[model samples]
Target: MEETINLKELFQILRKRLLMILAVTFTAVLASAIVSFYFITPIYQSSTQILVNQKKADNSIVQYNEVQTNVQLVNTYSIIIKSPAILDQVKKQLNLDMSVQELTNKINVASEKDSQVFSVTVQDAKPELAKDIANTTAAVFKEEVAKIMSVDNVSILSIAEVAKEQSPIKPQPMLNIAIAFVVGLMVSVGLAFLLEYLDNTIKREQDIEKILELPVLGVVTKMEEKKAAAAAVTKVREQTIGS
Candidate 1:
């Protein structure tokens, strides 16, 4: 036979297991809060911006073609900034004990659409280190690009500086706790429905009729012990008085 539950049954099941659901959700949020605040390490990010434009003399007006060429060159420069030739030098300059691939993983390069300005962002455990890496990477890329491409178009628009009050970019405790709470609520509600579905004991006349597919002839009413005893005593008194 097919079985289905309506919205009322679903609400009843959830209500019956409301305590369990609340407990699980609370535990999950607490665990997430603890891990996010105490166990996970915070990572800091720093970014530097560079402008890609051809170097022109003071009296020369910039040409349209040159501007377009510089815009296209930004893409190539973004790739070269993460290359081993550039990052290796950055690592050496910073005296960092990290490989080229590891350093590259910590760095990100992005440019705006149809724009000549690009940004280099670096992430590290130490705020100072992150700032240093961003600035050094930009400097090294600028110097190397001039030698490799025979063009001095890259100019540092802004160098990364360590923030006075540094805040980590990762390990957002509130967000983690919110996600955990949602997951826990879903799991608990699903478990409640599964448990309800697995229960097969007859609890009412409707249950027996539904499962057995037969008409219920009658239902035996259960009397309270005090009421039954009082009725028996009254009947015995009547019989004694009649005798």
Candidate 2:
């Protein structure tokens, strides 16, 4: 025989185990909150902006050629910004403990396609350190590029400023907590149903009869009310006789 579960039964099971599900969800959410607020450190970001332009000051020529030149040279600037020649000077000026490679890894250089403007960003746990790194790197990169290329094509448009607001990149509490809660709920509900199925031992008489391939002799109510009452009466009589 095939066995099938109905919606009503499912609803009943869920309702009965609702407390367990809620407990799991609350636990997951609380754990996320605790880790995010107390255990995780916040990260801060600082950025510097630079304008890239052709060495020639004359704008009479078609702007298209200048745009192409700027785009082609942007990759060179990005690499130069991370090179040891620039980063080593920055480290010396700032008296930083990190090596050139470490500083380079912290810096991010990006520019738009066919655009004359680009930005360099740095991130660190300390807000002021992030701002200082960005500004110093940009200034050093501008100076070094001018000295080497013998052209003043790169110029600092904006120096990085310390951010008033702090934002962390890691350990997103709300998102993590929500995911944990959902996963915990699914696991708890699955375990609940599994245990319930495994622990059920009482079998219907009809099922037993079918399995045995025999007819049932009779059905007994197994009532205990009469026997219980007679025992109570006999106890009362014994008490009265003793009195």
Candidate 3:
């Protein structure tokens, strides 16, 4: 019985604030759509694959040792790929306006354990620029690897290709709209309860009767517009006649 009464109150509050909830939900969805589609800039990602292969040698033992050495160097090379030393050359070679530090931030390098392949990913507002950055960073790293590590173990496995239909990863419209809708709904519900709590106006007959501890005789319906106007006119005519 208590739970049912609380549920009824909840329903009443929702019913009373249905319009505000809908208004807030609609506004939030619209704002999310607008910002996601028109205002936010799209970011494009491009990735290049490089192979960290061991240098070929005549001796089997030397080859095995070299492979192990290359595998161990993978983690170090991953860091070097994103370092300012390599990225600075990439920037200079590409004639990019971004600083080495900024370029490093935009680039990501990763390699799997025991795998010979590593991936270099770069993200930018322009798709072509992203691709160019990825490819150039890989090329710069490959050329300078021997100088940095004194081992020709790094090789360009695959160049970064311009994606046929690159999609932006950021400003996901559906996700943003969904989150906004939920947040708006929550905020609307909170505001509705707050307003209902703050409202001290007696809106129900029961409330008035309860406060006064008296039974209501009958409900007086409000007069219709036409009837109200007719009554006013009649009263004015009677007053004029009396005067």
Candidate 4:
């Protein structure tokens, strides 16, 4: 016969292995918490904003065409900001021990679509270092962009600053734990069903009859049940004798 599982069987399997499922899930959540809180190093973030606007030589108001041009240049400027030209100067000024390539990995230059305002973001293990890198990168980019492109358009709108209670941007413990909980639940439930499928030993009268292809004429009582019945009979006999 083609065998199929129903909702009741599914629930029964889950219920039978409920404690194992909970233990696994709890272990996963605990491991995630421990790793996130103690093992993983937190990454701190800092960012500085810069505005890309063209300067009019005649000292007049900026026009739409200039703004559009500046917006188009943001992509090119993003690359230049992380280039060796700007990073080299930043390293020298900051006296950083890391190489230019390593420093480039920590910096990111980004801007919104069709917008002239771009931001320089830096990430590091130290909050103060992150803030300093952000500000220094923006400063270097602003000064160097003029010399490289022969235009004085970039303006520093904001600089990065470290707060007293700065929080790390990476290794979120709660989120990690939540993901662990979901994965653990799925794995544990799957294991429970797998064990249920693997178990082929007879557990009931129906199993015996089904496997043997014969009718079950009688059922044998358990030893504990027989002992309990004999004890009850002996108690009744004692009571009758006393009467």
Count of backbone collisions in candidate 3: 0
lDDT of each: 0.92, 0.82, 0.87, 0.92
Write model 2 residue lDDT over 1-243, tens digit each, in one string: 133445666676778888887897788778888988789887778899988885565666657877788878888888888889999999999999998888888899998877778899998888899899999998888888989878888889999887466566666788888888888888878967876668556456775676787888887655599987898899999999999
Give the candidate order by descending lDDT. Answer: 1, 4, 3, 2
| Candidate 4: tens digits of C-alpha lDDT, residues 1-243 | 133457777898899999999999999999999999999999999999999887666868877887889899999999999999999999999999999999999988889999999999999999999999999889888988999999999999999999999989899999999999999999999999999999998888988888899999999776797899998999999999999
lDDT of 3 by residue, 1-243 (tens): 989988999999999999999999889989999999999999888898998886665764656666777778888889888888888888888899977888888888888888778899998999898999999888888888889778787788878777678788887899999999999899989999999989989988987896899999888888999999999999999999999
Give me the runs in candidate 3 sitting further than 4 Å from their true place.
58-69, 205-243
Highest TM-score scorer: 1
TM-score of each candidate structure, all chains considered together: 0.87, 0.73, 0.81, 0.86
Native-referenced Cα lDDT, model 2: 0.82
Q: Which has the greatest lDDT?
A: 1
* Candidate 2 lDDT for residue 26: 82
Query: Can you tell me which runs of candidate 4 are displaced by over 4 Å?
Result: 1-5, 57-61, 209-215, 225-243
What's model 3's TM-score?
0.81
| Model 2 pairs whose backbones collide | none
TM-score of 2: 0.73
Rate residue 203 of model 3 by lDDT.
Answer: 81
Each candidate's number of clashing pairs is 0, 0, 0, 0
Error of 2 at 100 (Å): 2.8
